[model samples]
Target chain A: MNISEERAQAWRADLRSSMKAKERTEIPRVHMPELDAEYRSHSRLEEVNLGLSAEQAMLEAKRCLDCANPTCMEGCPVGIDIPRFVKNIERGEFLEAAKALKETSALPAVCGRVCPQEKQCEERCMHLKMKKESVAIGHLERFAADYERESGSISVPTVAPANNIKIAAVGSGPAGLAFAGDMAKLGYEVVVFEALHEIGGVLKYGIPEFRLPNDIVDVEIQNLQSMGVHFVTNCVVGKTISIKDLEDDGFKGIFVASGAGLPRFMNIKGENLVGVMSSNEYLTRVNLMDAANPESDTPVFKGKKVAIIGGGNTAMDSVRTARRLGAERALIVYRRSEVEMPARLEEVKHAKEEGIEFWTLHNPIEYIGNEQGRVTHMLLQVMELGEPDASGRRSPIEIPGKTELIEIDEVVVSVGVSPNPLIPQSVEGLEVTKWGTVVVNNDTMQSAVPIIFAGGDIVRGGATVILAMGDGRRAAKAMDEWINKKS
Target chain B: MNKIVSKEYFSANVIKFEVEAPLIAKARKAGHFVMVKVGLKGERIPLTIADADLQKGTITLVVQKMGVSSSKLCALEAGDFITDMVGPLGKATHIENFGTVVCACGGVGTAPMMPIVAALKKAGNRVITVIAARTKDLIILEEQMRINSDEVIVMTDDGSYGNKGLVTNGVESVINREKVDLCVTIGPAIMMKFVSQLTKKYEVPTLASLNTIMVDGTGMCGACRVSVGGKTKFVCVDGPEFDAHLVDFDEMLMRLGGYRDIEREENELYKEALSSK
Candidate 1:
């Protein structure tokens, strides 16, 4: 056995020996420190969730029962070895925990920050069954990842011997990065094509800095680069270089993760008004193009009263961003109640703390515009929850004759997004669903075209970063197996 | 990074660049444009692919120094590298034998019209080109337009060129003399609005290539959205070209001015930085 294998075995044996379940359970969960709500919202946009200290991380790690049957693993989309990583952190081997995370996830820091743990891993925690708050797995995961990064000696995953195969991934988003990492680890030449000037796709442009800092995403990208993944930015796969062109350039496998960036509007009156735009546009401008700056080339309209429409994480991001941009009143005009909101619980809480008003059970019917064609007011329809709909969430039905007109300078529509149509339309044999998402085999993530595979927003419409990464890892394994079998 | 192969000055503020972009040069059609970024902080401005030399692996872009990004692009000389250039975006202009086609353009709009004129002329249409600018010195691509079209009429608002009239006047003159089956207008929104109005009187079908505010040249950002036929359409994907009559030119003109103040501020900063250097 290799020296590293021997070390891993010894480490596992030590962790198995220290199984003081009762004593570990006695320790309480650690709460993540955050910037002062009043100060953070009014001042510069800084990271709110302050990372756990070393002692705090280890203490929180002890709360994990490390059950014989680790159900948290099943809850995770990537199926990260939850017990192993948590136990490593418990033993104060933070670097080892991060390495364990890297075995499955290409972006531990990112997923730790943005992942909806309440619905995922933490939801399945054994501590939850014990009538106590579940162990802060997300916080611990972040601590380990951040610890490893700050230690100055980052770990690169072990790569296999070169197979002399070439792979191409469209969009440098989480899915594409994960696929590139895995393919590179298997010793295949991987190249990621990003449509925008900057890499990191939605992570860089969609998510705001206060929640998921750009540097954290950049670090994860740097890790992928170390794994032999080449990034070609400012190159749109369908427009800059088509699928046929990639095939001709000797790329044997193609993975499209071009993302669902086309934002959907309410189709209401005055939607095309001057101050009205999509959450994607609003975030892309502020986050990616620095449009919040007054002297920026493409400055976003700084409205006095900004309203974001929707009940998702994007809506929360847009609303919070508005507050930072000095919006006197930053409000979320969601159609459904708070319980039905798709945004993470932590994000909603943080938004509330940042003074974002939630106007739940109210939907905008029309945006009234002034003579200058700028949005001046919004006509809202009060709603009430009715019978559970197809998705099992109670459907919001409009309350008849309960309309109210509210004044607003700007409105960001964050209802949803559609899959980008470039790749699906460009590739001749590629099957596309009615929703414009590429139809792929569920098991393999492969498209109708034999050499092409797709995942992330392109395949799943709009989904979480972790789910996209899961699709990437699964596609990598399937592509590797298929390529070997063909050869 | 695409290298600028050649640079030619048409006027004090307008310049044409031939950049090395082999794939875009090969795939680009008449109406398609490339998103050009001059520097790290430069805005991704969409410039029409004025011409392409497939043999030389290059694409031409005519830029008017209207904002900071355009000025930065125009300042670059031959052999300088463009930070990022993604291309051949938007639906290409539909060229067909419409018997007699009237191609009307103003200022830098003449650049995009050159390729369409050539394509229409080659497709067996008697192309009558009307190139307009404020003055004779501001007129661009007259030689190229003459080479492509059967007849080239230069219109100067200040009457310093072939004719003293607006682009609509030139287009109206052609419509009165000949049966203009199709009119292709590529210019300022105001100019296209007037041209479309003139063509509507003659009942000639007209197509206008719109230039809207865009972040990503791809259909990702709806910043380039324009109302066409009472429906919202992304100019980056659905078209840079649309039916002239159905387009809401006034709203589009308003949307285009969304970044005007910001651009002026940036231009001032750029000038200050230049003076400091």
Candidate 2:
């Protein structure tokens, strides 16, 4: 055998021996440090998960089997080289591990924080087949990226020579940033236009700082900027400049990632009460605007008792925010039981620990207001689980004559959102789904108009950050090919 | 960023500014509005398109310093850059040669009336306008309204200026004098409600321009929803201008005051901050 192969075998033997000798082999997945429940319940703006230490990350990275066929990679939306990165961490190559992740993900730190790893990569781990605890991949990802960032030696990914082709990216969200990064990597001039004054579309405006800090998102965007991606803030694509105007300005291609910012409301009796608001507005006003501050020009309501409707990650966030705003009682009034909730289990656990009450199987029917026209109470109809619906979850059925009134000073509705229809309305002959999502080629993310393309919530209604980035990457590759053929 | 071309204050609370927005200038019509943001943390407030100079690529906006946002906008200098300004949005008023058209405007509402009056007169209809305010100092767009409309009448609540009365009294006079085909009122929801009630008695077809709490100024966020004829409609997309008789102003007034106390506290804080600075 060759000397390199012989050395590789020797290294494998040493690692296996060291792993077998330690009792850590039997240790379950490493636990992430969290804020004290009592302390955190009163505070709304501190990150609950304190993140993993280097020692803990090493322990989890060592648990990776480094399978010849990594199914975990398959489950990842961006198809990251999971085993390579994990093995890099095992070899003490922390910077290399981060580089490996940057090759696939535009926002490694963001995905590490918000992505549903338990449902994706972790679920497909080889240890799951043996009924053993899977490696803490998400935690390790966060650790490696954070380590590199804190180490003050962040190196942007390499890119090709400038090709001088200009591309327009609508909205600087995860999807737009991802697409811009890939296009810039291929030597194209990329410009991301955001309608809001600030960049990072929903990541900056919709998400609370306690969950995903603005600084982290800022660093990721900085990396893209360092790689030659230009950003133009306060430019709404359709209104500020039309698609035809973009074409006239000599942009070769356009990518729409404007996202679904629209908020939906239940048209029930007394919904027009002063205190009723969609979660989008509540979060945007609090997070994007300095509305939570009484000193800000636009201030949000600090309700004594706030009720968040629907059961999702946003609902949990709204309830948690209301608690932080000094709500004496923050409750989740959902129509379905806990089992049917769509929120990540970790968020649900965090909400529970923070003293948020979950009133499952209760659907709001009407709201009652005082003489001041502010909501004072919400009337709910008790619900029962019925047969499984098309989504494979049991549908909630209202129980007749079983109603109760919940005294609430505020109601934050987290029902759902439809795609923003500005681009669709501004452009002619662009196909859109009934749900207002832009119709596109699933493989290429190219819309019916060859000059235009779309991704993220504009194409998927609402989705995870990783899924949107995946669409952006696929669009980048396809756009590269299409542009090359055209040229 | 759009550059502010000129700014003039009409009163302690009312300010008129012309901005260079070529796209909006090209598309702006009567009864349309734009969403303006002063900075990254600024709240988006909709202002009616008071006038547009297409050749100069400028759109005029008249703002009243009522809340924290409007106060911030009023603090800007002529050469200052407005961070964001979207649209020429909402459906433009349907101006046809409906014989004699009477425009009833309240306070600063005279600004949005200028374009509608010009459009109706250009379409071969005689335009008669009633402009009223709390006091003479609060009245705006007087010369512009005069130049556009065939006839003009003015009033003030406390006899601080022209004939002492409300805008509804002027609407009654114009309807009684002329064979009014349609009446368009641009003012506060409460004022429009009163005018609509008067026009109903005179059997004058009336249109009321509405203002509501909005987020995106697009059809996306339903924050600016209003009930008209028992139907839910988004003001940003469907109709900012609707049949005055069909609109339920009570519901709108309640919804518009949703965060009144919070806004008041915020404005106090802003004033303190400015004073300290």
All candidates: CA RMSD (Å): 2.1, 3.1
Report the Cα lDDT for candidate 1. Answer: 0.89
Error of 1 at B42 (Å): 1.8
State the DockQ of every prediction.
0.62, 0.54
Q: Is the docking of candidate 1 incorrect, acceptable, medium or high quality?
A: medium
What fraction of the native alpha-carbon contacts across the interface, defined at 8 angstroms, is recovered by model 1?
0.50
How well is each residue in A1-487 modelled by candidate 2, as lDDT tens digits?
3322422555544664566523544667899899987787776568777888877787788888766567888889888887767767777788988998898888998888888899999999988887788888888888888888998999799999999999989989989999999999999999999877678988887778778888999999999999999998756777667899889999999999999756788889888788888888788777777677654555678899999998988888888888888888999999999999999988899889888999999999999999888999999999999999999999999989999998999999999888887788889989999998999999999999998999999999988888898999998999899999999
Residue-wise lDDT of candidate 1 within B43-70, one digit each (tens)?
A: 7789889999999999999989888888
Complex DockQ, candidate 1: 0.62
lDDT of 2 by residue, B131-216 (tens): 99998888788788888788888889988887899999988988888699999999988899899999989899999999999876
Considering only N, C-alpha and C atoms within 3 Å, which residue pairs clash in candidate 2? none
